[model samples]
Target: MPPSAREAANEQRRRLHHEADVVVVGAGIFGCAIAFALARQGRSVLLLERWLKEPDRIVGELLQPGGVAALKKLGLGDCLEGIDAIPVTGYSVIYYGQAVGIPYPLNAGADLGSTGGDTKGNGEKPSRPEGRCFHHGRFINQLRQACAREPNITIVETEVTKTITGTHNPQVLGVESTTRNPKTGLREKGYYFAHLTIICDGYASNFRKQYINRKSVVKSRFYALELIDCPMPTPNYGIVILGESAPVLLYQIGTHETRALIDVPENTPTASPAAGGVRAHLRNVVLPSLPKQVQPCVEAALADGKIPRSMPNSWLPPSTQTEPGVVVLGDAMNMRHPLTGGGMTVAFSDVVILSSLLSPERIPQLGDTAAVRRAMKEFHWRRKGLSSIINILAQALYSLFAANDSQLKALQRGCFAYFQKGGNCLDGPVGLLGGIIHQPMVLVYHFFAVALLAIWLVIKEV
Candidate 1:
């Protein structure tokens, strides 16, 4: 399937019955964007998905400011529009019934996000850049629509069974899929071929174990409850509620719906069925801690008697990509805890970096396995700047927020205290959390500052 400029021009992209220049195995956040990007570069792309239906999930509802910047890079910024998406200015964290506001940095890394502020410099200084939150399915539908409009891209609704590989060598040829025949309404076996195959099947990918050596670590789950027309202490700001137990997250995904995710660590007796299960815990523990205005909404949401749905909070470090003709990416390759809402931010950033490295100018032929492998190596190291910041912060913060030991509890209190100090003490950490800051040393500096402060407070109390 490798082609020269002349061969590529002569090939009919519409005749994509079996082969193409590239095969993308998921139409998710990463899949659609990558397909559209490669197709625009004159590569025939086959975008495969098990189902074309809009996704329904609480994860990826919040996109950090840095993610918005990367979305614009992919030219899919408009996908955020027409969905009644809320502008996220910052976060509201509540510890032991006391609340603090953590706003995005004024500079916000030269204003990376496209929403919330007029930075046109019309004499007004400009507001801080903003992040966004919305219905995950709505945003995904927009991305799929964008892919459908790309001429060189062919969107197929099929379940990718496995990768098709050459017998002589381990080089991936394409994918074997199960597609429903439109005429018979029965799924039939099919195979699609390409020089390059990208597997971004998301957090629950079936292909991940076959390709990567690392495994995801799961310690807790975020149980979800959608609060309708909920009132918040701070408008358009995400809320984090901390107590002696695990932390809870609340954010407005749309004008009418507020998503509430209450973290429950593994083996916590509060969530044990013998202890009256999760409902009893939410009603007795979480409800009382919420703001007076938001309390009623939780009551109403809980009144319906539907058990809360849960998603695992997992973490997996990055692994190098070395397999020829196949690249495993996105959540499959790496994942972090969802506590910071940084998943989409890292996904878009990876797309921005990987797409550029594999761009036509950089690697003229994707079929050139050696050239593509080199680019993947570059991508692994290049993505570390932001991904490392996010991965470390996510796993570490969760440990602090869900502190079960005295030491971690001390660190949690220090974090809340650090936020109150204002200036860099606040902006530096919040900027990093919002994905606007990338300086690892800045994070290290601030973390130790809090640790020192924690020690001082402990000594004073003693």
Candidate 2:
């Protein structure tokens, strides 16, 4: 707390200064994508990672086609081809014992045609490749390796301590971090200076608190248990098993690996059961509600999995930016339920948009402060619109399975019945939110008309 102590600390930080064209915090898929994009543009980039090992828990294993297209743009899709992620063609909605699957419509190579100054393909070739679910840890590790192979990029395994700001205004100039040397276990504090500082530092970010102090209110109603080596059916697809008690989602990833998300409602008492102990409870409560064929796989998955901690349905502050010189992307800026599988897609899109705005040619035209601010503004405008839409849809979906009252059940049944006939009141918002369509309200209007028609038909039948 003394002046000398503070000066020494500042001096030490300055001594470790690292200069780059850009400093990206967090080494998840989001950060890697941005770093890869920028490095391709000949920018000297530094990527900082808080942990060397990828966190094993319930996170996005699903990568939507839009995100795949983004990956293809970076020329990293070839790297992913080696990982063997299962391509998903569509999604399924479950309610009241019935399931309805919705396939994604093809994009028709519109963007690719535009690249050559010709609008060909005639809606035949998909603009975006089909989505796939992969093991998050494996996927991230692959991306990290790909970035390491690039000459313009460097990886720093350090925990960010603070963001350096310019005096007159709160403009981020650089980042201060600390990493322990593996040989000596001695902590070495360092500074990374950059023209731009991007925060992709996950949900709990110190820099994020410096700007937007928004906290997540929606707690986890579930925990995930990942398992391997079981006679479980290869869920070549994703499925949500809805039940009266806790709904569990089971799916496959990366060949032999299987990921299971078992809902543990907040209302349920925690007795701290063993890994597979919850399986008995699940059988007694959720399994009977599912199809008979699914029961064996569910039991096998439970038996072979490890019980991870609770999964929070997290969110970010309405505004994720507080400073002028820095921008927050991915979960750092905002997040929705992973079930919708839109996290990395939004983050990757931010990379594309931000890269365009931050190009050396454009930087002179826009100025540093103005350009970064514009990027953040545009990032929010695009992502927040998508986030709000996802939140509404996810909440509605969860409420149906979470409901216990008779009135809620009746409403859910009726809604499910209507949706079965190809009705989606949230379709417009969903389309926009899912990045399938840009204008969200159009899907909303279509959904409303469908709902009205369905209601009228039911009334006529009655």
Candidate 3:
């Protein structure tokens, strides 16, 4: 190829991704999913990412059964394959010293954007829904690969500086981003235009505060460590250990590697460096709290002298999308504690709802700002049935599991005991946690039931 022709080709590539029918910011979980969904709906997309490399993170490792189902619905289920992902069937909760197994409800189908979920039965899906766990980076890479294969989608590596809006109204026109020049191999400023822009820039989003006007509240920070060939008390389940110093989540990400995330709330004295730091917290508080068989592995991993990295566990409720021609999705818009691993489930579910509401059949043209805003309003309300339920339940359970107050402790005991009661008491709560059941009333009913039971237990002890 001649130099002039080569330069011309490079310039053409830049122009190609500079404009599209829809511009998606931040190719994280929601960004990747939505870009693919909209592309499949016959819309050209520019999926922009600040860094176009595989991401290594803690929060997105576990995909609840509901999320997996939604992924399948988007025709991206194959992303779960060949990543050495492990299947998550249920959760084993260990409280102080006692333990209980809360497997997912049998015969429950994935919500799949259906109203209130299929509480009865969907003969098409498996009777028992199964979740999947893997390295967060691997899973995301797979999703990105799938997006690359799509003809309508062009993935661009760029850092979005800010959004560009019309002077007349606050409606966003597109974005001003820093796109690297393919010819010079140096960063250069460029602009991307599209009819609609969706932001899914993970928990720490740059455009969120300016657009959504909601702040993410940090509940706690989860410090993570990787254990090799660690033997757990159970297989095919996410192990939740409460009363063992905050809340600990253990799930296998691969055949031999298990990811252990230990939650350390802010200003914790035990985790303070002066008080021997997080290692002391793990040695004194977390070590003894684990099952005896798993003790050696935690100790060995700690002995490696690897100081764990931490990610904030935050709660950001859904705010209405009033900004015309621009919408915020994923963690940028809302967040919840990772206690039940509901973030991905809620994200995928949101995509299902958003995809349905914004389908070409309904909106027809991506350029219609009015139709887009109306759909977003509908999305804000339509998604509440699942998003609110998951968000509320994740926070509430984190409160109960990590309860410090005496009353909360009592409720925590009752929550565990409620699971022990078996039947709907166990199935209902677990189903909601795994994102299998969509009924909000089920969460309310069980919460009240646990409170009442806690009262009885307290009185009986007194």
Candidate 4:
């Protein structure tokens, strides 16, 4: 049946009011990346951000080599140019007073496992393989600037309140947002209609439940501190110190500053801020376990009496989406423990896959529900190939490093021994950790190999 004249007029008015092909909520890394990618492809995108100022949160400081490559592919490589970001060569894990260095694969480049002949073998020098770490806010500002440079992208400072759903179907037709006046502090509600809506509001997303029916589970929390003038024994390498109540991660985030994160169990009681709780814990328990070189820095930071910032570590497994005209990306859709530092890598890889699937050449009209649905289905399955490895590794490695159980403790010892072996065993796992290797089978093989080694060691000890 044909729509009535009144209904057709209403549809035209809605389309005129919301003159965009896609409405993206949240202007964080994921949202900005998506908006930038779409706009470069000649699609009109409305990017809504709640805060106009730079965010001061602690997470999203590291970007894996794979993420850098994805950024290049998205034409946003310059985002890392002026952020004063530090190059991370590899990781140094200290277990039971012993340390082993696991570096990213020697010849690994932007694209891993591609059939480009080894440049070294071809008489050409290979570039150094490395990742990056920096202040999270600076990186975000870089991305926002990149998004704003595109002519097709519109940046709006507003807080999205809810999704405007269709009366009959489950599809999200648009979004409702509230904008506040900077001078008068008055707020006004507005509606922006679009053919598609993307939710990238990070972990505390409000629109996730409307499309995804699952909730994020808080597995643990991280207490973070900044250590000034604290340089690691090996520069450009991240340090993971085990044997504490949980794992403590230390990495140089700037030339003169290192970021230290201590994992605290979710059920554990935290001290009150007024009573010097976090400082006491660091002084009493965490400091003794850290390397001697950084002890003074930790001591100074504790004595400074600044409360360490706390962030919850949550995990949300991915699910196949059946919702039409809506897509969820970044930490909101799926998350894993940050022990592996693979969150932003996964999010960037997701954007790469999704943008390719919904490229302008493929689906010219964003309103084509059937085509977008098909692309999203493919995106979901194709993304798993890479995301599963990173997600599972983060959880599994955290279990071993945390070593809450007897079996996990054995596994932890075995893992250290495997890294000490220093051949395919070490390179393969580090490659996966660096986000260069996308194969889950390789991860599974190395994981079980470590387990078998652990079993052998336990038997020999007995």
Best TM-score among the predictions, by candidate number: 1
Q: lDDT values of the candidates?
A: 0.87, 0.65, 0.85, 0.83
Q: What's the residue-level lDDT of 419 in candidate 3?
A: 86
What is the C-alpha lDDT profile of model 3 across 47-80, one tens digit per residue? 8999978888877899998888888888889999
Lowest lDDT block of 10, candidate 4: 109-118
Clash count of each predicted structure: 0, 3, 1, 0
> Which model, 1 or 2, shows the larger lDDT?
1
Candidate 4: tens digits of C-alpha lDDT, residues 1-462: 333553344334434575578899999989999988887776778888999699987778888887777787788888988878999888899886688888787767636433121474677866547788999999999999988777667788999998888999878888888989879899989888778898899999887787788899887789888889885866888789997568999888888888999987755444345545666666777788888888998888777667788899898998767678888888888999999899988888899899888898999987899999999989999998889999999988887888778888888888888899998987799889988888899998998899999999999989
Q: How accurate is candidate 1 locally (lDDT)?
A: 0.87
Per-residue lDDT of model 1, residues 1-462, tens digit only: 554654344245435356788999999998988887787777788899999999999789999898998899888999999999999989988999898999888876465855445456689877887899999999999999998887777788999999988999999999998989899999998898899999999999899899999899999999899999988788888899998668889999989999999998888887789998888888887788777898899899899887888899888888997899999988988999999999999999898898899998988888999999999999988988889899889988898888988888888888899888888888898888888888788889988999999888788878
Residue 456, model 1, lDDT: 82
Best by lDDT: 1
Pairs that collide in candidate 4 are none
Model 4 stretches with alpha carbons more than 4 Å out: 1-16, 110-125, 269-277
- Choose 1 or 3, whichever is better by TM-score: 1
What residue pairs clash in candidate 2, if any at all? Answer: 222-264, 428-443, 428-444
Error of 1 at 218 (Å): 1.0
- List residue ranges in candidate 1 displaced over 4 A: 1-15, 109-121
